[model samples]
Target: MSHALNILKEVFGYPAFRGQQANVIEHLVDGKDCLVLMPTGGGKSLCYQIPALMRKGVAIVVSPLISLMQNQVAALNEAGVDAAVLNSALPVEEAQIVEQKLLAGYYDLLYVAPERLLTKRFLDLIAQIPLALFAIDEAHCVSQWGHDFRPEYRQLNVLHTRFPEVPRIALTATADAVTREEIIERLVLHDAEIFLSSFDRPNINYQIVDKINSKQQLLSFIQHEHLHDAGIVYCLSRKKTEDIAAWLNTHGITALPYHAGMSPHQRALNQEKFLREESIVMVATVAFGMGIDKPDVRFVAHLDMPKSIEGYYQETGRAGRDGQKASAWMVYGLNDVIQQRRMIEESEAQTQFKQIATKKLEAMLALCETNSCRRAYLLDYFGEPVAFTACGNCDICLNPPDSWDATIAVQKALSCVYRTGQQFGAGHLIDILRGNQTIRVVDWEHDRISTFGIGKDLPVKGWRAIFRQLIALGLLTTDSDSYGALCLTEASRAVLKGQKKIFLRQQPEHKKYLHKKQLANDCPILDQGAQQLLDQLRNWRTETARKHGVPAYVIFHDTTLMELVRMNPQTKDELLRVTGVGAHKLDKYGDHLIEILRIA
Candidate 1:
């Protein structure tokens, strides 16, 4: 029983430590370095936060996003911790005041952006203060191989050089073995203990569908599964983000667009609105969602395939952070695959890097096309094996995809590519197989090929699926020299000569679940009495948050408010027993809550 555990219970209001939190905290409190690979909402902040409080002085947190710092500092202050952030967003006078206070030892924790932390002026200022530890959040950004690489983060090795006496902790929600090694090497945490929590997010239902009427499909998903919930819809381009946001708004959903193209003020305002309000969907490119700490995001949908599995995992990890039932829905097609391949080939990265990028793209495709347990495949990608056979929560486990022996169809598709001299891409090959009388097919004389019109029994999408699976299976390769022309690989010869068999998933029918008046019964629901109290509590919270100019979650998370409603505590002592009601919060809101509970 250490003081850290006591602080966790008294300040954070959690009765016990989850998973390896206590171990990580103990290691850090012992003045040692650590690399923590916990899930998004697995209490990574607590590991360093508790140790910082229990140790000598201020804990400096290096974060990538200003919003992340603001959100975290606000939450810490709400929990009765003296925390502040230093970033360019602060005015000159305000920054001077904060600097003076920081020098006077008035703050327990200080959050700063990487660029600001690396400044000579800030470094000199920190030298005068007794420091507790250095917490490098979103540590994967230090690796070039990571999806969200920040070059500024690479310079963080200066921390080890400058503050040799202070301990450091690097934390990330997403990182594979390769990225993990890179974080340790780049951050110079060679002797740090590594804590790799399970990456399994069972509360999020994984659903990947082949693209068909993508906008309609997205609308259907929103209208049915995640209606009236806060979520994020990721797009590939800036223009697409704006278009989709507008479309969603036209259909009676409050939506906003966020991308690098937007002005800084506009992006900040939109993000603030999303965090403060409910049922607002943010349509954005990868420019958003690095350190968004919003806990109530109910879903994350992707209209395009991510460049790699790491990117997909990190993006989807944003949802269900509050441990609520959420959805990770995506729609991809062969076009997305081709476009991603083209982008990779056109990049200026070195040849070896290009090869690595191509392999990652193929891995993402495999996850999409996998008919087995999606969670198992995903966890296996990160080098973690689960004991269970099936996750029972993903789309694949709920409705097993149909598979057909496509030995003959695959051979026909490969032969068509070979006969076309491997000069045509999937479109021309599909045209040749489906006997499309397109001018390109006619000019190439592919209509007279032996494989021509032999696959008319299958539709164009079906043939495309076979070719994509062939590519994924390594039976076919894309020739970048010829602008993505299809080429038969050595493995294709066995399938063509009847020595090998191929299986392909039958194209699933695009079925949309009907919009029910409410979500699934299994999800957290309120009875009529509790619902009335919840409504009143939400109204009070919104007003309180507005007056204080902080996000509603800072005042109290929706989960805490719901607990108040369910318990219907009529007395101040009873209200203190509710979860999330620590001494500070209980004193702040106990009377108000008890009054509302009694009136309801």
Candidate 2:
């Protein structure tokens, strides 16, 4: 057997490694340092995991998230591996126990937070162990230029200085060229093979909707898209997280809130509930989903714009980790752009950091507003070449967007912005277009202009689209603090006074897929009778999974139960023939299936 295959089957219970994991593992196992860039669900863990399992001594993994450390340690224990974690959550005696185990070489893997590793006592204890390799997860945090940066990561260079003989591996699911260079320099990876995997997750369906009653849109999406499946809803603030979580629960969806503000126990309980599939959604700020090892998350919804495309990609990639079909849906508005910019402008980062953040925000905005394939743009940002024009999975790909000659409309919007002295945002501009005699307009005496009501032919939504497209096209600028005030760009001179013709796609009213009917023939077993049986089976499965603290599928797959309901199989032999029902599972679960089928 190949070395990777052996590790996969024996250690990970798989037959093969996915994507570029095998190549990465080989480089690390050969005593070479590596810088690996893979997508979230792209099997990044195994790149270091398999190599760690194969190495001579216990591998020390430096991770940024303490919760993730506990999760990984639990997962490793379930896989029958000797693993332990060092964090503040443990009591002194428990921590001492783990330390003693480390000294006795009792663990095959040790996961530690970067901050925890920097302590003098921990470093002294680590010195006594026969170290195999050093693995740094979320290595992007080492770079000050990267999102999610930790000041403690820069101190990680002491690993190289202190343990010169140990091979090191740094891994992150998101990083651009600038962040990549910073990670290498900050981590002191002077000689490391860089293994970059393709960033495309073809199984994910990408969709972006205009921010219209965003709460309703999110609820509608959760209800209709994949009802009650495990998912995440990322809000940009703590208040939004709490409100959204409460709203979802009141609407009958089991959702929880997670943020750094919550007590550690509460956060742990919520995270544990989500991982155990007792909760269907986790409404969170940026404090969720890093180093989450859960594999069956079915969707990720963003109620606000992320700061960068890399952040968006990494956040969305958390869905569909099992390679099953999933979705990445986002709701964004002009204010999101300004809010993000304001955050960067207020930060203590250098000028280069500000520029990079601004450019990344623009790239993300372009991706959202582009009439082109969303997947293609995302892949291109990760430095992957894409010859395929349309991926047929995203909203833009499935239904072609409509383009309109908006030369007159762009001219009207720009003329209004310029005539109004660039002091208003899209709302006032839209009101002006729709001929609303609001007090702001009368106070500014803007009603006398000829271009004031010329845009009356376009609806408010249409005019908003124009303004968004104008910002994206660089024909307009938004004030960072005042939340999307419309200001003219240099390109505005060309379009405002008819010096140059402008073209813009009409903003779509509702995405076409939202109108699509459920497939008629996909699952014929969803009829009334079968549905009744399915519900009973679901209850049974949920109880069983809860009792065992595993995902529902671990108890019984939906497909298997659906088939049994459809076939109404009365015997073990008949039940065994259904898809996903192996002999052992049939033997264990056969009687339960028969009991449910008898009632059906």
Candidate 3:
């Protein structure tokens, strides 16, 4: 059997096993069951993948996503390993062929869906094989508390009970303490070794912006910061997904929308297009989750707020999965909070369940409003230590926002609601501030109300900011059933009565960058010939990766080339010392890159 560290270098192209990977691999090889709670991009696949190749028989991988399964299978095939996935997309003949391959021992790993486990034919076939291990990907879905709960996942214990001697490993990128315990119970890993890697990805910078012309803000961010990077823009609804995707396409971005509203063939086609293409952005909804396995996603932008932190974490984790620098950005507003609360309140869940869900939703809101180090807060929440309080990548860090005491402004807004019978939206009230004397105000004859036009002290934008912040802070609530008409919740009563203080942060004006001339001055690496060499290496890597049908980094990592830039190596022996350059890889690719460097 190959050593786990060596396997890391050979198959996955890493120089060393990340924290807990080696330990988990050892436990798996020793035929002990394990539950691994690794953050996304933390290399959870390696723990079972290495053992699958080294041990006696096929490793059955139960995966939740068909597209993700296909991506992984393609990657394995590119690495010169035999792998196949059985999913709904397969034809009868193709399914039989894969089944026959499994029985004939031609495939090292078999990716199957949970629904396939209960089939008599498949179970009988599995009984005949000398099973090496069982791997459950996205195992958090087994629990109702999890963001991506799957009813079929609860039936996975059959694999454990029937193949008691075989080792099992359950893996998930996002799971809190409750979900973790639920996965163990549902999977029946009674004696399994548990591997809990710190759920932290330091390379990702998290930022949340209060919703203001959110589409324009998204466009500006993409144009300025992520012009050449692969990204995913998440919307809460299909219409918005399509609209944003169309907007991006109109503005020279190669973008597509994927949601259940699209035809299945179109969804599959769009997903395939994203996987095969470079620098493409996918604008999608929550329906696009569970099966997306694209590495090197530069950023994940949430145009609308998610239902819970677990959902947000899992979605954002898709970025920086290659362990490179990436970002997570969100735009949120008062309407999102109201709609989310209404959904929770209307659900058939018991009061306790609703309370738990509400708490999680509030936590997500707090994450949005927090002005502290986005990275530090996120990492600390996931149970990790961060030495720095400011990460310098978020909106709060880049341009620290100033706050003003809005006690009076909030009182005016709330008083207007109280005097107007709590039945007006933001636009109607904003008109009163600017003294529009509109027809509605005239009909109500409310232009003479005590609080009418009282907010003239602040700009229209300022009022909008106060209202949004107030709504987010739970001091005011919007009645969504009434087309988002503003209302004073019980929490708002205190503020209107001057029993509490109100503070609102100032929003920054948007800056648009119109010239690429600044690009040459932006990257210090551009001045050096080494960067040109690195670009050539990346180009060659992309082409070579396309030829092999794998992610570009799988062939040779960017970190490795950046090291080469620093080391300026000219010999194969020298190149091997660079991180991520394995001996097997050195023998295969070292000469080519070394030759290119010499020419440069």
TM-score of each: 0.97, 0.88, 0.89
What candidate 1 gets wrong by more than 4 Å, as runs, is 511-519
Clashes of 1: 0
lDDT winner: 1
Give a tens-digit lDDT track for model 1, residues 217-292.
8998998888889999999999999999999999998999999999999999999999888889999999998888
Give a tens-digit lDDT track for model 2, residues 528-600: 8778988898888888667757556555555556667778889987875675565445555679878878977
Superior by lDDT: candidate 1 or candidate 3: 1
lDDT of 3 by residue, 1-600 (tens): 357766666655567777898888888999999999888878788889999987899999999888889888976765556889998889999999999889999988999988887787788999998988999999999988778889999998998778889999999888877788888899897787878888777667676776878888898888887897889999988999999999999999999999999999999889877876789999999888565667778889999999888899999998877676677888887667767877877789889888888888877877777756666777777666777878766657765677778798888888887888878888788777666789999898888888777777788777777777777687777674666678888888788778899887777654233222333343345446777887888888888888776667567656677777778789987886677676666776778879887888
Q: Runs in model 3 with CA error above 4 Å?
A: 289-291, 346-353, 383-388, 433-435, 508-528, 549-554, 560-600
**Cα distance off (Å), candidate 3, residue 246:** 2.0
Q: What would you estimate as the lDDT of candidate 3?
A: 0.80
TM-score of 1: 0.97
Greater TM-score among 2 and 3 belongs to 3
Quote the lDDT for 329 in model 1: 90
lDDT of 2 at 36: 93
> Per-prediction count of colliding residue pairs?
0, 0, 0
Better of 1 and 3 by TM-score: 1
